[model samples]
Target: MLSIKVLGSGCANCKRLETRVRKVCADNDLDATIEKVTDYQDIMRWPILSTPGLVINETLVSQGRIPAEAEIARLLKS
Candidate 1:
């Protein structure tokens, strides 16, 4: 199963990102655990300074803004 973490400070973009992550996992038929990191200190633990960071299985895959669906799918496949 894939482990996904959406790191942000509970902004509108953060919520949207989380939603997209869930949809992607479902649409792709992937077994994933998606979690939202809303705490500032928790978000800071990663090497991302931007909101809406994407961490897949503890690896920082993307950050700053929302990513393309194809990009996400490709990431999951790898």
Candidate 2:
């Protein structure tokens, strides 16, 4: 299973990102563990300068903005 993390402080964008990740996983039938990292310290460990970060398999894939659903699907496949 893929390990996915959405790093943020529970903001709108953060929630949206998490939702998108979940949708992608569901649509593709991908097995993934989606986690939310809200603690500042925990989020910083991923080298993100802003909230709404997306991490896949412990790798930082996005930050600072909400990505499109198509882009998210692509990321998951990678």
Candidate 3:
């Protein structure tokens, strides 16, 4: 299974990103576990310097902004 991590501090953007990620996973029938990382230290562990980051199986994929659904689906598929 894929491991997906969303790093944020429980902000609105973070919540929105999580919602989008969940929808993308469901719509694409992706078999992945989604985890929310709110701790600053954990977020910093990744190569992300911004909130609302997306990490897939330990690979940092996106940060700072929400990605398009298509892009997210592609990431999840990979």
Candidate 4:
């Protein structure tokens, strides 16, 4: 199983990123637990300095933008 965290300030982009992540996971049949990190302190634990950050298994994968489904699937696989 994969642990994923979507970090944002509860904005539109954040929600969209979360939705895309879930959709990609479902499409690829990946078993992932998705969590939303809205608190600034919690989100700052990662090295990301942007909104809509993505953390996979405690490693920061992306930030500031929504990643493509293919990219997300690749991340899950690795």
Candidate 5:
């Protein structure tokens, strides 16, 4: 199973990103554990300059924007 993290401060964009991530996982039937990293210190562990970061299996794959569902699905597959 994959380990995913959605890092942000509970903002709208962050929620959207989390929703999309969950949707992608459900649509693709991907086995994964999704978590939300809201604390600044915890979020900073990843090299993200902005909110709404997406981490897959401990790798930061995106930041500052909500990626498309297709792109998210692709990220999970890789």
Candidate 6:
């Protein structure tokens, strides 16, 4: 299973990113655990200097913007 974490402060973009991530996982039929890290401290711990970070299996993959569903699915598959 893939462990994915979205780090953000629960803003609109954050929520959108979360929703997109869930949809990507579901569409891809991926067994992933998607989590939202809303706490600032937790978000900061991931070495990302921007909001809406994506962490896959403890490896930080993206930050600052919402990645496309296809990209997310590719990441999850990898």
Top-lDDT candidate index: 5
TM-score of 4: 0.96
Over the stretch 49-70, how does candidate 3's per-residue lDDT look in tens digits? 8889999999999999999999
Q: Which runs of model 1 end up more than 4 angstroms from their true locations?
A: none
Compared with the true structure, what per-residue lDDT tens digits does model 2 show for residues 10-30?
Answer: 999999999988998999999
Model 5 scores a TM of 0.98
TM-score of each: 0.95, 0.97, 0.96, 0.96, 0.98, 0.95
As for candidate 3, its clashing pairs are: none
Q: For candidate 5, lDDT tens digit of each residue in 1-78? A: 999999999999999999999999999999999999999999999999998999999999999999999999999998
Better of 2 and 5 by TM-score: 5
- Kindly list the per-residue Cα lDDT of model 1 for residues 1-78, writing each as its tens digit: 889999998889989889888888889999999999998988999999888999999999999989988888889879
Worst 10 residues of 1 by lDDT: 68-77
Instruction: Tell me the spans in candidate 3 whose CA falls farther than 4 Å from its real position.
Output: none
List where candidate 6 sits over 4 angstroms from the true fold: none
Cα error, candidate 6, residue 56 (Å): 0.5
Badly placed stretches (over 4 Å) of model 4 are none
Report lDDT (Cα) of residue 4, candidate 6. Answer: 91
**How many clashes (backbone N, Cα, C below 3 Å) per candidate?**
0, 0, 0, 0, 0, 0
